[model samples]
Target: MQGFSGRFKDLVRRLGVTLFGIFELLGLPRVPEKKDGEGRGKG
Candidate 1:
């Protein structure tokens, strides 16, 4: 039988990859960029 921890890790990895792919397809930003207050008004 496989170890519980190993199986859990594999499940988590799969979930992460799946979620990332979905986000990529939807054109969503994974990480937000740090913007300075000065640039707020400018497009």
Candidate 2:
């Protein structure tokens, strides 16, 4: 039998892929990651 952790991981991976597909269908752009001290009052 398969392990519970393996099943959980598969579920999470599938969910992430589905969400990404929806985003692509809607033509949404991914948010850019924040750089080091970029928004930490370090101008």
Best by lDDT: 2
Model 1: lDDT of residue 34 = 64
For each candidate, C-alpha RMSD in Å?
6.0, 7.5
Q: What TM-score quantifies how close candidate 2 is to the native fold?
A: 0.62
Which whole-number lDDT from 0 to 100 does residue 20 have in model 1? 93
For 5-39, candidate 1 gives per-residue lDDT tens digits of 99999999999999999999988875677678744
Look at candidate 1 and give me any clashing residue pairs.
none
Candidate 2, residue 7: Cα displacement in angstroms equals: 0.2
lDDT of 1 at 35: 75
Error of 2 at 22 (Å): 0.3
lDDT of candidate 2 over 1-43, digit per residue (tens):
6699999999999999999999999878967889986777645
For residue 22, model 1's alpha carbon misses the true position, in angstroms, by 0.5
